[model samples]
Target: MKKKSIVSMLVAFYLAFGVLFSSVSAKIQSEQAFDNKIVKRLKVNNIYNHIEALSKEPRVAGTEAEWKAVQYIKRQFDSYGYESELQPFTFIEYKAPTKVSVNVNGDTVAAAPFTYTPNGDVNGELDYIGLGTPDDIKGKDLTNKIALIKRGEITFGEKVINAANAGAKAVIIFNHLSGELNGTLGNVDNRFVPTIAMTKEQGDILVEKLNSGDVLSASITIAGSVIEEKTSHNVIAKKDVTHKQKDTNQVIVIGAHYDFVPTSPGANDDASGTAVTLELARVLAKVPTDTEIHFITFGAEELGLIGSNKYVDSLTDVEIDRIVGMFQLDMVGSKDAGELVMFTVDGEKNLVTDLSAAAGVRTGTPLTYGQEGRSDHVPFYYAGIPAALFIHSPTEPWYHTPEDSLDKISKEKLLETAKIVGSAAYQIARPDTPALERAKVAPKEVDYEKMTGGLK
Candidate 1:
């Protein structure tokens, strides 16, 4: 054939090959069969009930509630006939005083501790530092005075550091918007002042009086403080039988964060994830797999993903490479939340996404795939293993709010998600079939018209 003819032929072949693969792929069976007998044991509502009980109180790191939560998880794993281990590590524990309030011109105002701030009490002149910064603080008299800083222009930690360096007695960083302020001051352990953050409204009350030349004598007290050497734990459970895998040296990890913020119950935030992981453990224990499947519940996820970071660091490069995929379930039980989405770091294609999405498609409840890495998946993804966080986003209004209770869980969503993920996992794990090489193939975008020969 002539050179031009040959080039045209190659293009035609690729198009034909692509067309054929797309047509045949839809008909592929995702799994031979799910032992629903095993899956039914994973009652979604039972998991929600568990969430209902555990989330009754906040499980902040290094606290009594956190320990209680850990015990509960241990108990569940024990009942399921799995080997459970609690890996302990220490992190800074901030204990805020029972009540944090501000007195602007002797009028008490509402406020809360800035996450990780040191504990202290101080009464001094209210100085509006206007977003306190090292440069803006020059020639400012902050010694023995309270600095009322705004949120923005830098991290809260930087603001605290700048104020402390300028000899400010206490730091009050208010929210940029009008509402209650809650969040951390960063993970670094060097904060020196008793700093508290409040809503923009609360801070503006003080700011308004200051502008009016009111004697802004303020009393700032942070019931919260930082503690060094505080400990946290990761609860891990192994199924009764070993998993079956193509590569004997490999493993698939499924995990979720069990901690919740002080005000939020976190039923969907992660109770859903934890419950599902446990249930899967129960079902998969008997079914068996070639590779190991480790089910874990993580603590201190609300604390800057500290627990996950510690867990990941505990493993070496060889261990990391052995991890074929990590599936992170965060907020998987909310029906009002949008359709299921799988997120990865840098939005690149990876193994976890490949498995979950493919399984979702095959299960007939396809999830919208996108890139995200805010949950426990980050650590594994950073280590170069394929990892993804499974979540229902836009969450509920109750998210991070006190209203996120057990009733918010959606069994249908949970069951669907579990079935898809479980079956997808089974397709790879079933001892019946030789483990297929993780075909790193991007999913073909559906083209019904072309596949049906332009049928309407």
Candidate 2:
């Protein structure tokens, strides 16, 4: 009986010590948390106003409009009381063709120029190369001919390269189904010849004429395709840690691409994203936290993520590791787009997805996670940092078109996206306390189903 009493007393004392120590080590929270303050400060009208101002023109990279947009973003950051800088990088900027056409035996057909296609005028006998795969190009005499290829089975770039190797003067890729074909030669290349796209119907008629032994001659002209070195800018704003002694060197990066495809206003493609970043920076500027949050808007995303890639490449191995999480917003305010979804580069869930899922649950707009790597988040993810792209899937029909105007932006969508991201960022940035009750961040129960979708 005496030994049992001694053991029970020691166990009780140990439990009391554990509880006291945990209480002392945890952060203290008020009835309302910092995220609440952030959310309250976020106004949909401000986001909409910003979007309206930004989407007024086509902000293509390396253009006067692009530079104007960059300055505006930087100014907004400065007005929000954050130090902002423009980081410039050089790239071979490709100019969209102003004039493109194909004439078959004097019958002119409308054509679209592929990206990075050199400006040229070529006259040759048109030959059909199905799909334009390597197998299709081999053993075929395409000397001085214009290769008419179909859009399927392989990339437009591959077809162009294959035709070039076969001594073709130019390439004409037609859509596999209906409507006009719009594509790229993948990237800037010295081997790139004049490449253009046409409707499937136009290609079918040309093939029929060739197969019927009708002597066919075609003329292809692509004008205004300039390849020259140009500078693109990235706007970055930093929110310093509120508590120096308690500072966690870990940084949170929230980014969005501020550039758009040529001729597109990009209200939904990313003016929505850029507006959200600015708003978040404005709200979080006054919030006290032990973590640093960096808000950045990248340029030249439509040109294959050049801006984001450069930013990540500039970071040292140690600096890369210091980044705890990155949230990228793209196309987040379109009413016609699919619901909000978080995407990781490897299609796997990480800390970013976890916090977003929890935030979604709290905000009543639960988000789902999936896999994709076609945006600014890719570079950070590739560097082994936790990053996720916050975008609406199934994108609006106006994506990358002249129709992507301010009318497509939904204010509610912007608010919801901003709310979820702001809450999630605060979850990691709030002061670390000894317990959940005293923590500056509101304790949220993570919904795994919403985060991982019950996947492995």
- The regions of model 1 sitting more than 4 angstroms off are 1-27, 34-49, 52-58, 95-230, 239-247, 432-456
What stretches of model 2 exceed 4 Å from their correct place? 1-32, 92-114, 121-183, 195-224, 261-265, 334-339, 392-411, 433-456
Query: For candidate 2, lDDT tens digit of each residue in 344-445?
Result: 989888878877886776667888999999999999988888899999988889988999998888899999999999987876677652111111232445
Weakest ten-residue segment in model 2 by summed lDDT: 433-442
Every model's Cα RMSD, please? 7.6, 7.9
Q: List the residue pairs that clash in candidate 2.
A: 25-434, 26-433, 26-434, 26-435, 27-433, 27-434, 27-438, 28-438, 29-438
Quantify all predictions' global Cα lDDT against the true fold.
0.75, 0.85
Q: What is the lDDT of residue 226 in candidate 2?
A: 77
lDDT per residue for candidate 1 within 280-327, as digits (tens), equals 777777776766678888888887788899999999777776666788
Who wins the lDDT comparison? 2
